[model samples]
Target: MPGSPAQAPAEPSAAVRSAAAAAWWTRWWVRVLAIFVASRVVTTVILLIFAANQGQNPWTGPKPDYFSFATIWDGLWYNIIAVSGYPSTLPTDGGHVTENAWAFMPVYPGVVNAVMFVTRLSWAPASVLVSVACGAGAALVFHRLLRRVGLSESTALFAIVLFCVAPVSPLFQVSYAESLGILLLAVALLLLVERRYGWLFPVTLVMAFTRPSGLAFALALGLHVIYRWVRRGTDPFPVRERVLSVSLTVFSGLAGLAWPAIAGLVTGSWTAYTDTELAWRAAYIGYVHLVPFAPWFQGAQWWSTVMLGIPGWVGIVALVVIVALYAVLLFSPPVRRLGPDLLFWVIAYSVYLFAVFFPQSSTFRLLLPLFPLLGVLALPRSRVYRVLMVVLFLAMQVGWIAICWGVAGADWSPP
Candidate 1:
């Protein structure tokens, strides 16, 4: 029998075949695409419903077309940059604030311009195309990151769904830098975690050009080096890896400043970028103050001077309480389940926002970069909990779109 041709392996059992099929369907990439598609479909449906309810046809309404809706606020500024270019001289009115194209980053507008050239479409349509495509890419990368951090396939998919339904997620479909910035950041982080040091440089560099959050990536890279060295002991990484890591940290930091440097060079003024930004801020605070928590103190003082003194003070207290609650959540059981790298980026980004950015109605949109951290919600397996979370996200998305983007216009907040 041994001398004879070995008999062919027996056919697998039906149960084994079924399990193999199931496993294939549950593969990480497969789940990621499925979740992304399903989420996008849901978002599209919600947008359509809202548009119809507003008596604005997606095709004919003057300001009701989806492209116009998506291309409002910052999108409009980006469009102007796409059609024209940055102004040679900053414009002002009555020695006060007016439009300054320099306040907007160039990546989104650049992409829109390229798209227009290729397709012969106008800026608005091109902007939507770039944003939606980048948004999809960001979702896929984010899902992959969740899995890399040890989530089960089901959990990772759920997290992607949550990200799509986030309150400010509409911004992802608009002509904004958030989608491209997040996609680049996710790529940089994934490369760093996988120890693909050579690839992190360009990815992080592009992220820097995409948004101010690029500086946060540099900080995250530095923190990553320290974390590895401390956790794994000295000389844990090979010499090449160590060199590449240090190079990326330094180069990405510089790249984050490249845009402002370019602006200054073009204008022949070192403070061109900051001056333009402060001009926009003048309407709110009238000046720039970098001291920590200055805004909170200023808000309290301003409230005291206003008619609703007690209520204003109470509002300031409420804001502090809310921030404290978020801090507590960062250390909660579910969030602790994330890997150290993920945790570090989330904390570093939040710190940057608090230290440098104003707290405004647009805060949620600004937080879109942190959406990946919401994957912690997937840690809980309770069906009721999952259902409740989805319901809450959907309700908040509807409310935000209705109040912030729908009725309020530019008077309330910049979408």
Candidate 2:
């Protein structure tokens, strides 16, 4: 062996080097970061195009800049909260409550305010900064969530790509609490999937205020408990874990109601929060008492009559079809592969929306929370399908921005 001529050190072949490069690029974190950045760039261009054509509107002057445009719609509400604290007395229209800062949670603005204080940035830039940062965090966590649920690295990364380019993904870079809420939700869900029950408490509390999904999450947790109990024969739901899950569910429920209770205590009106939320829908259906599972029907009827000049029953039927489609998707192979925890979340969140939401232009934005569904969209290995879906999603960003985000003369659409 020693007498053999010394062989030159073998170098990695071209294919091996190329593969190493590809592997480095495809590392989970690296891919997620790239996807997040690329998606934001695409969304930013779309937003800028819309912003360039934006006429003088309630929120901005004609041809507003990127920050100005990004901070429009609910961004304006968030800005208001960031600058001035919530009103001690709710603003009213005629004799009823109207849209006010109470509808916007404190966590997002609170974070933006902190960023502003530390960085000496204005509300628009600070809010955008917070949003973008949280968007990045959400993207990273979402990849983890997907991988935790059995997706391959490629599928998980592709799911993140889809999530970043989603029509509502503009919220990730804009001045909305959505990115923050999503970041927290991704973390909470990852924790949920990992069975890290103790960490979920604080995350859930903060996420509740970040957006109004705590009740939905509580419902999901309750259902998770039931499912675990039912499967105890195999899954082994120990007493200690059961106690934690149950207590967390109750805590989450309390957290869901905490904002309303705070608003009531501060304003001397128990209905303060609900009334404020109703005010937004009042534009469509006029003053109406809150009724569980009624808003969607009412909203369907209102949109059908107003937009299509069609009978409201037709809209109700359409709603039924939509719900059916969603149900079918839930049971489909791709979604079922996401595991019961994520499935539980999607179902619970959809039920929550059905019970409380008034579907409108903002419905797309509200659906952002169901981001786990992106895994289904990412499941197809077809190159053409994947590429086409990305293009379609990008196009949807343009349409979503034009119809929902851009204010074009007495616009009723609010993103």
Against the true structure, what is every candidate's RMSD?
4.4, 3.4
lDDT of each: 0.75, 0.92
The global Cα lDDT (0 to 1) of model 2 is 0.92
lDDT of each residue in 1-415, candidate 1, tens digit only: 7689888999999999999999999777776667666766777667666665554432235437566666666777787887787877667676643558888888778887888899999877888778778878888888878778788877887888788778877766767888888888888777776889888877777677778866777788888888877766653777787788888888978887888898888777666776776665555667664465566555554544453557566767876887799899888778867777787788888877776666656777878877767788776778898889888988898888876666333354555
Q: Which one is best on lDDT?
A: 2
lDDT for position 195 in model 1: 80
Error of 1 at 220 (Å): 1.3
- TM-score of predicted structure 2: 0.94
Best by TM-score: 2
Q: Candidate 2: which pairs clash?
A: none
